[model samples]
Target: MTAALNIYDPSAKPTAGPRSLAGLTRPQMLEAMKSAGVEDRKAKMRAEQVWRWVHHHGVTDFEAMTNIAKDQRGSLAKAFTLARPEIVERLVSVDGTRKYLIRLAPGVECETVYIPDVGKSGALCVSSQVGCTLNCTFCHTGTQKLVRNLTAQEIAAQVIIARDDLEEWPTSAENRKITNIVFMGMGEPLYNLDAVSDSIDIMSDGDGMAIGRRRMTVSTSGVVPKIQELGTRTRAMLAISLHATNDDLRDVLVPLNKKYPIAELMDAIRAYPGLNNSNRVTFEYVMLKGVNDSPAEARALVQLLKGVPSKINLIPFNPWPGSPYECSDWETIETFAEIVNRAGYASPIRTPRGRDIFAACGQLKSESERLRASARKG
Candidate 1:
């Protein structure tokens, strides 16, 4: 009889197999296939076939590509993997919001969320990094230590997994349940620019998933250097997580503000490509009670955003365990909104969604990974 090896052996070595193919751009896919011994002409053909199966059909299995020859399909499957990181945990809100904890590699995990609403559009909130570097005071994802960046395939798989749950397959230019995607789940997207850019390119390609560039928004906590590149390259709507109005308070609320102050951040916003009345930039202002949601602050916000064609999303603070902040009073938030509205900015108080499952605007955590890590240590 063969001896059983210890499953929990810490020193057990792992072998590298196929890397993820989730985030490849069309040109990258062609290059990858060509390098893997596929002929140039056949590489293009195979890339299109694989793209259709992966994006349009949402198939993760190589065998599902019916058009590809059986032998080629087997060989491709052996050569390259098309699987998402294992989903570690899943949470569903009372309002049907779904958040998934996905494991990218050993000891690395990230969170992704799916928000559902009737008659209107739904959104998939994806993470760019396993943990966040910004450490925004209002966000739970910021509480964890910064892990390595997720690959483009890992980023793209968040959408694929959402589509898998929603069953919105055979992607088209119009009419889909996942109407929008927001890179506001875990990490600062600007820190993981190359992968995020590559993944979104595949998502926005007309021949593939074809999600509208306008419907997609990449939220940044004022990463000044890469802001223009994001606008010029992606053309996706821009959303800045501007929690505080002044530099001093913002330096605390968003730690990155210490490096690039509000002045520089706003300047970058102004320099963003295609900023106009029709394509107004979105400024996300989280309302914290007594901290930054005062009527004076709201009016200052109006003055602060002067000459910039923009709207504001007033997000009431969503509290979590051991958080330092509290949500602003309903009347306080309303009064604040009124001040901005009177100043010609469309400041809408965002309706709280997915709070029951801790999937609200600022309430996302990856506890499953923590538990798994603990188990391994124990």
Candidate 2:
């Protein structure tokens, strides 16, 4: 009998080059099909048929598409591939959070996380860049220098990988493990907005993966220029990584605030295409020990978001090795949240998931592959 899939297998390797059609958008699929010598009239129809199999059902092999004829499948296979990246390691947290160290190319890696019991069902936090450009002081990922931006296909492949592991094939509304997608992983998503936007289109297409745009939230560390454009293009929910209330504190906590201060950031948020109670912008506030988590600060947060509909996610700082911060005292966090709760906003002290596995918020780093290389050399 075959051995069970080793979720933690370290020898996993990537399918090199741009041959994989698994993460292509609908239009991209059409282009690939035409390039594969699919006749002009038949290309559109064939692309649609194969799109369902690749995305809706998460089929890796063209042969599995029984709806398409054998001869065409052979042609398609010769033209392109549908291979997933190397899952260098998969770690599962006791709390049901799953972290994946995925290698997209040689020397290019990023982490994707699936947190269970979030939103309606669960959320997959996918990285947009290899490391990070925004060095938010409290975040562990911020400590790593930026490697590069992930391609549209590379970004979408994270979802594809999660779906494969979860065995959530043939997308359905019920019994779904990942009902939402959050761009709150290793990188500042806005830095790679174009790929982030295209990947959203691929995953959210009703004819394909079918997760709604509203359920896919892109969290940015306040990229003022792209905030409105991101809303206009993707219609995905906007989440600002606004850790502190004022410019001075925010500058220290989120250094990007120095370039685009709280006032400017808020202005961009307020002008976000569809601002209302129904579609409130999320403000992620990481509560650090004796740092930004004060009752007065919470009140100021309420005032800062006076007119705009907002949900403040008060995250208790998840510490990392040699990190410069500690989580706020439980009572201090509760007190801070209480002030925001008194306001007309939803302020939930985000329960730390995957802290034991280093999969919690702002804790993701993709050094596992390097560690594996060192062990191999030894």
Candidate 3:
């Protein structure tokens, strides 16, 4: 077994002292204010004021909250912080995709990617863990062993850091650059359920980040038991990393399928709360050449997803160094998508982006590890 590198030391202190206000929800913020000596009647008001400053205005320092009284601001600053993860490296792809290597405590790093689309819109892919536990053969992150789950603060910090980079402040409904958030980066989000949900709650809070739940997507690699819970708790968009149609093939493609097969996964999806035509589940199918991208597999996929409000995203396998799989040819992917489209599913072949900077789908792995490996080799 490959040993996990750059794992977070749980015993180490996360930060110097003060609690982070970045990921706290409204109620949590109010409670925090109360604990910090704010009166019961004034706690809610003070929390709201701090929330607007930290999230709405993207102010890092409590002193920047100009409306708050000087003494109150000093007390709040002494009690809590709004510090985000330090950006160790920021790489901008030639095609306008920006990948940030964010450092969460010492020796803990994860990557967040921002893919720019047409107009003032883009998607931010955030990581939920320092390293991934899932060893999906085709995934770059899977090469690293399980490290640790990110805290709610760390998870929400990705968005805050990205917003800082984009200069997307004042939390606008119009002219938004980071319009969508995908829990599809470094680690399996469902594995870190509570933190991920809390971070989502903080991000989707109307008076703060204001990102609608509909625009946020959580992708899981068939964690069946958590699927229903995720839908009920978060009510955000759902996507499955379902590269294979049959259990026999899926077990090999996604190791997690060995525990919860396709049938069980489908059953979980069917029972997902608020699942309907408008709120459709997405099935992410990475087209691996000569593996799970045949026309027959597409037919099986359509049959498997029958009666489930869904769309199939056919992704061309993004290559990484030492990866064993090859992307399916364009003609092969087209043929496979045609079968699904004919069966009434919207199977769009996802155009690969940020390939030059290794920021495309399935390409996020921390640069710290890569550099370490390079150093050892040298």
Candidate 4:
């Protein structure tokens, strides 16, 4: 008979504070177990059980892991935490969208949005970094400086927190309110691709969160180098934040275009893995009045995506405080869509959800920086 494992060291003080295992990958969890003094032989098995409890059940307490031996559970508890980050604010829009302002560290914060009726069910848009490096001129998050790339754990925690609030626990395929996820919240996901890749592994694990890879879409403002690598690693759908049809206009709107111009971006889109009629890349074009919304520009867009498997998502520019751009008139948007639609591509006008509460697309700036600015003014 095998001896019961007791890996606890009452006299051993931790080198660092206990970190929550809520969103760590299985390999990460196993490493955490070993650090907790779990025998290497026992760490793997223990990690799988705890991973299920943390992800599938969304449990916040080791005591709730009923299958584990009581003393062993106490040992795990001493080694790690299951607590969630502090939610600074939870704002809900009249249109049934929910926005969460999560404080990751003392000064590091990010915003996540839950929008209903997106895709087969609904979608949660999560950030991969504290702020953005791409100063996409029309976006609120661009106004904030890049603090740091979020770790894999931090990125996954956004989904974990959203799931907790929606009361959508136990990881059932049925009754899932958030059927899809978009990396369109605050950060440029490709800039933090390693963490994003690890997070997808955790979120898609069959015994845990179980969100399918196809249902996760990562939007980028033309980070050309990482495009193919993102597809190969995560296998998530790709969405391009291509606001303007021409090079000069795109350079003004998305400044990153200066770095990775439209031609390079288009080439990358063409070579994205698994791109077919069924698995299409989405081009997100924000329609700005009198800027990139002309019918001629629409024709140019058709030419841009000429031979690619793609659908264009026409986002009516969501306005923020002192934003320079105005949304294109409805008729203008329709005419532009008509031109693209005529070219045998689907051009869906994205509904501006959570606009009333400033939770809509291109409007996700966390309160941390805003508060700091106010303090400077004070």
Among all candidates shown, the one with the greatest TM-score: 4
Task: Sort all candidates by lDDT, best to worst.
Answer: 4, 3, 2, 1
Cα-based lDDT at residue 283, candidate 2? 91
lDDT of 1 by residue, 60-100 (tens): 78998999999998988877888766888888888788988
Identify the leading candidate in terms of lDDT. Answer: 4
Where is model 3 more than 4 Å wrong at Cα?
Answer: 1-15, 118-120
TM-score of each: 0.90, 0.93, 0.93, 0.95
What residue pairs are clashing in model 2?
A: none
Candidate order (TM-score): 4, 3, 2, 1
Give the whole-model CA lDDT for all candidates, comma-separated: 0.82, 0.86, 0.87, 0.88
- lDDT computed for candidate 3: 0.87
Compared with the true structure, model 2 gives a TM-score of 0.93
lDDT of 2 by residue, 6-98 (tens): 122112223554378788877778887887888999999999998888989899888999999899889888877889988998999999999
* Cα RMSD, model 1: 7.5
Clashes of each: 1, 0, 0, 0
Of 1 and 3, the candidate ahead on lDDT is 3
The lDDT of model 4 is 0.88
**How close to the true structure is residue 75 of candidate 1, measured as C-alpha lDDT?**
84
